[model samples]
Target: MNRQAQAVVLLLLGGAVIRACFTDLYLNYVKEGLRPFLIAAGVLLVAAAVMTLWYELRPVPRAAATGDGPGQPEARAGGHDDHDHHDHHDDHDHHDHHDGHGHHEPRVGWLLILPVLGLLLVAPPALGSYAAGQAGTALASQQQPSDYPPLPEGDPVRVSVLDYASRALFDKGASIGDRRVQVTGFITAGPDGQPILARMVLSCCAADGRPVKLGMTGNAPAGLADDTWVEVTGRYSDRIGRDAVNDAEIPYLDVESWRQVPAPKQPYE
Candidate 1:
């Protein structure tokens, strides 16, 4: 229909596909978390595309062919609008490209504005550190029988991935240090020749998660792949190292065994 409307429709259709496909990851510079909102935005795009196509395909009524006569516009069997709407412009006749056989659709340019407004006003939320780097990164439901098995009821000093993470970030490993604890994550390389220490990040899926690695030396020499899940059992030593993004060695657990686990269903922090 109009130039602006066509642009809007095409934009919405294209944006939907891009967001859906790439919404898995965000900026590499920032160790971030999975962005569920962007995924939702992508879904919206697909819906907008379908609506645009529908409006374009709808048919509209064409003027009568026999009406070279007096004031008669879209004539029907029963009388409706009695007012003489088309008396002056009776002589004016617009030519149709096709023969009067097929019906024509009015430009549905009006519908395209819906998603355009959404895109402009309310963009999707971004992957933030709050989501991925939080202390409580693991989901309880995703826990397995013994990924980091529940400690036998004894001193009750064993901390868990959920426990350490859920605590205040400023608290460090204060509560669990020198106590038995367990965690699960992917195996990543530690700076220097340090073995045993590895990093594992949890994200919404595998995409938007910030890398939260458990530093343990002398574990796996080959290290681990980019995204491998592992279970480590050790004491929560509060030895501050660096940050996850900066390769900073924050205090990590001493690993007993970094068992490789399957990627859980909800792969997020």
Candidate 2:
């Protein structure tokens, strides 16, 4: 293929890969082995785009002067192909786009998406006490921390996911002593750009994962936009709730060091 044609293909693939990465339905649809596949796809797309840009800027070969067929279109002496009078390069020439460039209409993936989207775009009660009671499904823990060496006492400590879940559920933040912990995940924020509490999800393994949010509290780190992976370190504090959870069943962390991080392979726990 010509350099221009090749560049176009690369650009198309890159755009499709990016859309697949960002679109929510794409996230959910390609829900298994998505991290690796998406990452690989992204790298390929980037490489393609770079190659395209390079090719686009590259000088084309000097037109071997066949002097233009007497009946054919030819460039003027100064070298800009004057197409002002030409019908050969018509205004309506078809630029067939590849279907692999995964663009889709605004169709909701699941039927419940309409309501979910409404809740997101507008204000809706957060998934709270109502959901707490229903999310009692069994999750298989792949390995226990006991099998690994314990983190030595330092400025910050390593806490188990089990411990974190329990503390959040029962003691809230009151039970934790003066200890700092670090957790990392993709950033998810509110429309107003507050750091919303979030959870990492898994379909089969920790591969095809996306983040579901909990709630946002206090001022978030400046310049940290949603879906940007970050490493957050802070003290876990409890926020007492109203309703059934009013009896202090809420535990969360007060964020401290929120630094951007690269996406990990097994992004979810």
Candidate 3:
């Protein structure tokens, strides 16, 4: 890649990162708090590209404007009769050494544009059922003893999958007794080939996301597809005896009602 190509690559990368940050696409791959750093990095890269362009466009000094050095006379229009021809040739060579060789051609630098194009054309999706399943059936948070405040005043209290699972597994569902709770998550196939309510929790980014699953037992909508987002209102039940599936119990929910819903902007909690 030449200096011009290098500058283009920098501009492309910087623009892509900045665009992702501005349009909230970065949330799919990283935490929202990284926006400032992404913007800073993009600004630096674009500034560097501008500097490269400036350097490439800068005017080169004319070697013929002044004599080569002390005791040397400028060459004539038709010939170098005013100065020694051999010394003039040497001086021209020295000037070429200083001005002819510009920035290095970037041979492998073109590969740097691939990531920028990828981010621009095809965005990376947020982690979904495939990633969750691959991470195994593990709760992102460990089961621990704690006092959970009373459920907010609502017929069907809205709670996250992680919160429900933590309460069910650790607190023995005491706080969940007879209270109809609503939880939202994508659907995943259970060990018994039944639909399971699943949600992924991320500490920082999708790379660290883990799944929290709850078995659904009720009138699931007809043809409920995998990864279909849904809001299920249900209460904890002891119908299945709560056996462990993948190192974690598939807390059963007696689904009272459910409906399809659009996937949340931030898929992970």
Candidate 4:
């Protein structure tokens, strides 16, 4: 690609990054902590692209404007003579052709625009049920069981899917007791086609995310499509099952009620 094309690509890419940083879209791919770094990197890329365009478009100085010495005419004449001689030799040599501008940038450089356009025009959605189904429940086995604080005073206290799973599996349901809690996550199908509540856990970005699933029993709704975001009110159960794909232990939630809800701004925990 030419320098102009490179500058355009860089400008689009930088703009896309800045736009994602300002919006909630960046949460789909990465952690909230990386926003400042992403914004700074985008600014640097934009600055570099602007500088490149300015340098390429700037006016060139003429030889006469430089006040060349009298001997310059003779030097120019000799240079033309050498050029004529080379042209004469090339007239008979079929393999001596040149494109004149001399730049040989790889054509593959244009491929960079694909990702730039993707980010600017149609950013990808966050990892959903398909991604969750491919992986097993992620429970921190190294975490020892302990007394967890009592649930806040609410008929159905709001809690994250990961926290509920950890308390149910690691704490052996002691912390959960008989209190009804509300959890929100997308639904994924289990081995027997039952709806499972799941959320992805990301240490850094979506690439390293793994699912934390809870088997929905009791009055849990049926026939909900995968990736349908919902709020479920339920109590912990002693029932546990193994993942069909990886045999990871999945805790159970005895759901009492459920309702479809819009997806959250931050999909991962």
Q: Identify the candidate with maximal TM-score.
A: 4
Write candidate 1's Cα lDDT for 175-255 as tens digits: 443555556545444444353322334433334344344446434424456455666666655545554344434455555
| lDDT, candidate 3, 47-163, per-residue tens | 999999998988866554434456665566776564567677789878878884664554577888888899899988887777766766565337577677677889899999888
Question: What are the per-residue Cα lDDT tens digits for candidate 2 across 53-101?
Answer: 7867877554433233456655667745755433443433322233423
- The residue ranges of model 1 lying beyond 4 angstroms of the native Cα positions read 1-47, 64-172, 193-209, 218-223, 243-249
lDDT of each: 0.46, 0.48, 0.78, 0.86
Q: What TM-score does candidate 2 reach? A: 0.37
Q: Candidate 4, clashing residue pairs? A: none
Query: Using lDDT as the measure, which candidate wins?
Result: 4
> How many steric clashes between backbone atoms does each model show?
23, 0, 1, 0
Return whichever of 2 and 4 wins on lDDT.
4
> Taking the tens digit of each residue's C-alpha lDDT, what string does model 4 give over 99-170?
444456788999989999998888999999999888877774437557777778888899999889988888
Which residue ranges in model 2 land beyond 4 Å of their true spot?
Answer: 1-152, 160-165, 190-193, 206-219, 240-250
Full ranking by TM-score: 4, 3, 1, 2
Residue 8 local lDDT, model 2: 55
